[model samples]
Target: MYKKILLIMLCFLAAMACSSPSNPDNTNNGDIVNGGGSGNGGGSGNTGDGGSTGDGGNTDIPWTEIAPPLPVLDEEAIKYGIDISQEDSVIKEQIRTKIQQYNKDKGGYKVIFIGTPKSEYTQQSSLAKLVIDIAEELYKYKKYKYRNRY
Candidate 1:
């Protein structure tokens, strides 16, 4: 009975092997045509005539310019209602003083302060999560001011 079962299993294995497509490398002709002559026959590999832009080709859509993030004020600046863009020297001194005060008060939780040109600021890590919050707040303030003006 064991021999009979083994023989039946062997026959089934032989039938399966024979019934399957013989050429492992050669895909079906319909698949080849549909796949752009590749084995899987999918045309996903083709990105026809798109201009190369080093990293990837320039996509079809136009790119929009994003504005730089707003800087966060230390507690004193926030308390005093100081605008960040008031004269350059005064702003610099105020920012420096604020950093020094923050360092003194926080006790070794060092905040890496930065002053950057608008373009560079947009590209830097110094304006990460905190900058996003400040930008949203500043946007609300600007909107409020605009509404009050007109």
Candidate 2:
């Protein structure tokens, strides 16, 4: 029961963090941000252009097309009952397309990327704990209004 509750809470938090605000005209300009899990790169993945669109230094160019890839479930991820799948990429692409179309329809450069914190992404002993850490980091990012200090 505890695991189930945690899973549901994780789903809720992830969805809430990913979803756009209900009010399109919220103080934030429309920005479609993309953040990657820590990988081979060293930098914090910020482009650093300060275009005023708020897309973490990204330009108006929509991200390129990507065919859905196979799910690469690691033991840690599966043990936590997480659906680590490529379907999320497809969904994100669809959302990006819609946001781009919305920007065009509105005749404005509304879509922008709100930057993420530049802190190091560390892994925890378990996927659940890692997710909790990520959630807390995201909360801090917003609460402190973190910027790319690079």
Candidate 3:
């Protein structure tokens, strides 16, 4: 068993020695001997600046991200919650805030609401569609807000 192990070790060493280049630079004295007929003989051909992966930098083109389309709160969604008819951004924000609060009180999940009291969404004829639209808006808003996050 000992002799067998020694023989295996010797064989592995021999294989490694045979695989390695005798002169990695293909050089002798101070000069390289390339097979090219040119007398300027140097084994190396010009290697580039150390093999860049190119994802991080080293380019002219600048990276830019196109902003996604803004979420549109439909007329029905605005209509269901309150009577604010102003065409102002502040009112829009207030409407969204109200919707979110109502959603939270009604056991909201992601953006959908459930188990709500009748008082909150009393307009039964338009309530379901309004809730769906509001939920969709909320979903889009959440995604946009957390765009950079995992």
Best by lDDT: 3
Q: Report clash pairs, candidate 1.
A: 35-41, 35-42
Off by over 4 Å in 3: 1-95, 102-125
**Cα lDDT listed for each candidate:** 0.47, 0.42, 0.47
Model 1 lDDT at residue 85: 35
- Per-residue lDDT over 9-57 for candidate 2, one digit per residue giving the tens place of the 0 to 100 score: 9999999978956554332232323332223243233222334454445
Q: Which sections of candidate 1 miss by over 4 Å?
A: 1-64, 67-87, 109-150
Q: Which 10-residue span in candidate 1 carries the lowest summed lDDT? A: 47-56
TM-score for each candidate, following the candidate numbering:
0.24, 0.18, 0.23
Model 3 worst lDDT run, 10 consecutive residues = 44-53
What local lDDT does model 1 show for residue 90?
53
Please list all clashing residue pairs in model 2, or write none if there are none: 30-112, 31-112, 54-113, 55-112, 55-113, 56-113
lDDT of 1: 0.47
Task: Quote the positional error of residue 58 for candidate 1 in Å.
Answer: 7.1
What lDDT tens digits, residue by residue, belong to model 1 across residues 1-150?
999999999999999999887655443443332323333343342322223433234344433332235665666435333234344445445444454455477643223444333333323333344434445655687699999998
Which candidate number would show the highest TM-score if scored against the true structure?
1
